[model samples]
Target: MQIMDVLAKLGGESGFALFFMQGGWKNLVMIIIAFVLLYLGIVKKFEPLLLVGIAFGCLLTNLSYFLGHGENALYHPEIWANFLDPQNTAAYHSYGYIMKNAGLLDFFYIGVKAGIYPSLIFMGVGAMTDFGPLLARPKSLLLGAAAQLGVFVAFFGAVLLGFTGPQAASIGIIGGADGPTAIFLTTKLAPELLGPIAIAAYSYMALIPMIQPPIMKALTNDKMRVVKMEQAREVSKTEKIVFPMVVATFVILLLPSTAPLIGCLMLGNLFKECGVTERLSDTVQNALMNIVTIFLATSVGATMVADNFLKLDTIKIVVLGLIAFAISTVGGLLGGIVMYKTSGGEINPLIGSAGVSAVPMAARVSQDVGRKYNKNNYLLMHAMGPNVAGVIGSAIAAGFLLSVFG
Candidate 1:
């Protein structure tokens, strides 16, 4: 009778058995989705640097549900539930409680909760950015600013769809096509939606090549698409060194809430341009960036536990995110057409799509589309002007929303 009792306890505790008893089909579906993401990241090379980590994190979080209620599980939904409550005054205390009890995944998540990882990632991006294109063609800033039209449009769309003000703001930022910005805003306004928003942002960012080309072709005719921009005036090294400081000072003074993100971005740019901090710049651009990407991607993915992620809300977020992206692309293209007309055919409308802020990816798509029309027409440098400007534009827009809702 004792031996039978021992066998019964072992069977009850086994993860294989608990999988069926606990989350059931939802867990299985999430696990399969995780594997599909892994396959896309690894085999198909879809944003492998971040997606692989995200997929692994998703796998681990879903697997925790099968492990029975124990310390070995990487996530605790009950603990997470307390933090999700918007009005919970003791959210910080609950975070501390999770840190003391839960496993290492929860520990890494502190960076997300505290909004550290996004700022760090922005710093790294700044370290890698070259402001020469933007400085040479300051007019591109208008295109960048114009592209953000989608963000506001999506905000109203989300609000009309029955989301709260903060949640609507979070969803609208997906139009910016900036993953870190989306994560940063979502963490502040709607922490619970962080996973889906991050995934949607990055997924769209990776698909920029595929998504933007069709839109670019559809929006601009053959004549406008093939227009070759004049060579940008050479930007002096002193201008490059001074631009970050001036822009950072101006934007932050105008909107103090953007200091954390825009401040770090300019700091990294200063490290690069100052010519005295090559070591720091290199580290920020490469080593520090890689490390933070791992932590940020994994923490984001871990938030997508089956129970919370498999809801109607997640589906809505996904749909809304896609719509936001499409609208942002249209806004950028429209802005480009205006510039094309204003410049009297000197400006290629293709470069305008770079205003969506997918960095080099959006810029590259612009270049590719231009190449299809005329082989000698290179739009990379010109597109880059709006590409980097879009980064600053999105950050400023996020600050505006945060001031109002956060």
Candidate 2:
């Protein structure tokens, strides 16, 4: 009788037995999804740095949700749900309560909820980035701004689909092809939708090589793709140093909500451009970036607790994200075409597709496509003008959306 009782207790504690319970299936399903994401990140190498961390966090959160009982669970959704509830005013955005009751993920999530990680990530990006290309060709700013057309288009589409203003804004930012900005905006406006938005943003960013090529080919003929121009004029050290300060002051005055991201970005850029701050620049570019990425990715992934992620809304978000990304590419290419015509075929329209802010990757795509048509055509430096500009454009667009909706 004693042996039988012990055996029964052990069986009840097992994961298989838990699967029979209500809502247990959702956890199991999420775990499977986490496994698939892991495979994609590890085997396929899709944004491996962040994706692998996110997948692991998802796996850990879901597994702990079931394996641990009550207050001991690695993530407590109820805590976050309460944090967002108006009725629980005492607990609303209350980090104290979270720190007291929630688990490890909840602790790491503080950086995410407080908007620390993404801003720091921007700082790192700015530290590594050289705005010299943008400074050389001021026209690249037009292409970058034009690429943001998808953001507004997707916003209106989301509204038509019955999403609220804030939700739509969060969804629209995926068009920027900037994961940090997307995560930053979503956390502020639609915390509930963070899981879907973050995944969509990163996935589309990783697929830029595949997604942008078709759009580039469809929009441009051989002549447009092959056109190359003279080298950009050199940018002086003074222009590089003054650029970040002037932009930060002007932009922050225009939209105070942008101060965090824009300020940090410009500050990082200043560090890189300023001759004295080599150590600071290197730290942000390497160590700080790597650390913050791990925290941000894992925290974002923890939100993928099955019940929140497996909805029809998730599918809708994925589809809309793809549409927004495609449209942004189209918008950039169109802008490039206009420049090509206006310049009497001196400008290569293929370079315009790099205006979606995926850093050097987008610019490289432009170079690859341009090379395929005319091997002598070197569009990389020209394409970089718009590539870096897209980063600023996306941040400004996010600031606008936040000003209106936040």
Q: How close is every model to the real structure, measured as TM-score?
A: 0.96, 0.97
Model 2 / residue 162 / CA error / Å: 1.9
State the lDDT at 20 in candidate 2.
66
Q: Report the C-alpha lDDT of model 1 over 239-283, residue by residue, as the tens digit.
A: 999999999999999999889889999999999999999999999
Residue 354's lDDT in candidate 1: 95
Candidate 2 ranges with C-alpha deviation above 4 Å: 1-7, 66-70
What is the C-alpha local distance difference test score of candidate 2?
A: 0.90
Supply candidate 2's per-residue lDDT for 190: 97
Clashing pairs in 2: none
Compute the lDDT for candidate 1.
Answer: 0.88
Per-candidate Cα RMSD to the true structure, in Å, reads: 1.8, 1.6
